[model samples]
Target: MHPLFADRPAAGRALAGQLAVYAGRDDVVVLALPRGGVPVAFEVARRLGAGLDVFPVRKLGAPGHAELAMGALAGGGTLVRNDQVIYSLGIGEETIAEVVAAERRELARREDAYRLGRDALDVTGRVVLLIDDGMATGATMYAAVDAVRQRGPAQVVVAVPVASEQACRQMRFVADGVLCLRTPSTFFSVGQYYADFSQTTDDEVRELLRRAVTAG
Candidate 1:
């Protein structure tokens, strides 16, 4: 079993330790990418006494290859795409438009479901800590950073349990500080580092968000 997933909460607790400086800072907010990132962020948020919430992003998958994201769209109109991937895949403009449109709808739905009557936390002039379980290509995270930047945060910090060295480097340019727990020289998929990487369900995401909203 990979060390990152010896236990899910343990992994998060370990990550929290590395982020101790941010503890008890009211100006620091932790925004986690759902669904896998929520559990990890929960531990960090609890330890730091920081507010936790979800930031939804949807991949603009290539035609017939849902796992291959040519681009991604995050809630708040942030869009990031790898044109090379689209060109290599021969994805047409119409197809790309369709995928982005569909993804936007899904992103909005998730935001509505997770946030409900609660208002989005104002990021302006505050330090934002973006958390994810792990990153592979980082396309999703790039879009997320762009989305958060649109809100005019005072600073953006990206924290993750594990990621490829390349992904970590790329993310550093987009964030003020990057807190990556592990950056293996020979990296594979993010799942390779996790023991119980079971898919997180929508119901679980909703419940977690509900709890976060109530607690904050």
Candidate 2:
């Protein structure tokens, strides 16, 4: 089968198409999980006439299983752990604390680099659209939703270009709504659906956020 997207921008546009119901809304805010999600959310916010912001979240990978997310930390100080994974692997508090400390530093660094002194947009009493390029385990989105929920958003929606079938289903339980353009049962990785899945650089993320601010 052909790839679903040429790149992140294409994926974003496709996602925006499905979200046409939200067009011209003043109370909508799109918060992207950077640095990849910025490009995706930029197009969604632009197309929907919504505000754009980055919701920095850092995944805590299981020790020795770097690709497996055991939990995540949100910018708003919310921590989400997969207790099943933690207990199954016998991960202790000392290990968890060490990982949290390391991820906290990285999360702060990314927030500073992406925001550049800008304050987060207020989502109180408004619809919050949490976007990401893709979801593997849904750990990051769970943490983001948990953090954002505390701030009193009227609604929280999780959107992605493509995701594993299981991940999309899990999100539906937490998010007020969930929209995924593609959910392949045989999903290997997010990059598989994009023809040009290049790594999104920090410079690109910063530039996109700058443009989003200007666009707003």
> In terms of lDDT, which candidate is strongest?
2
Candidate 1 global lDDT: 0.85
Candidate 2 per-residue lDDT, tens place, 1-216, comes to: 689899999999999999999889888999999988989999999999898999999999999988888899997789999898899999999999999999999999998898899998999999999999999889989999999999999999999999999999999999999998999879877888889889999999999888988988
The residue pairs that clash in candidate 2, if any, are: none
lDDT of each: 0.85, 0.92
Instruction: Write down the TM-score of every candidate.
Output: 0.94, 0.96
> Which residues of candidate 2, in runs, are more than 4 Å off?
none
Which digits, one per residue and each the tens of the lDDT, describe model 1 over residues 57-131?
876777887766798899868889889889998888888888888888888888878777788888889999898
RMSD of 1: 1.6
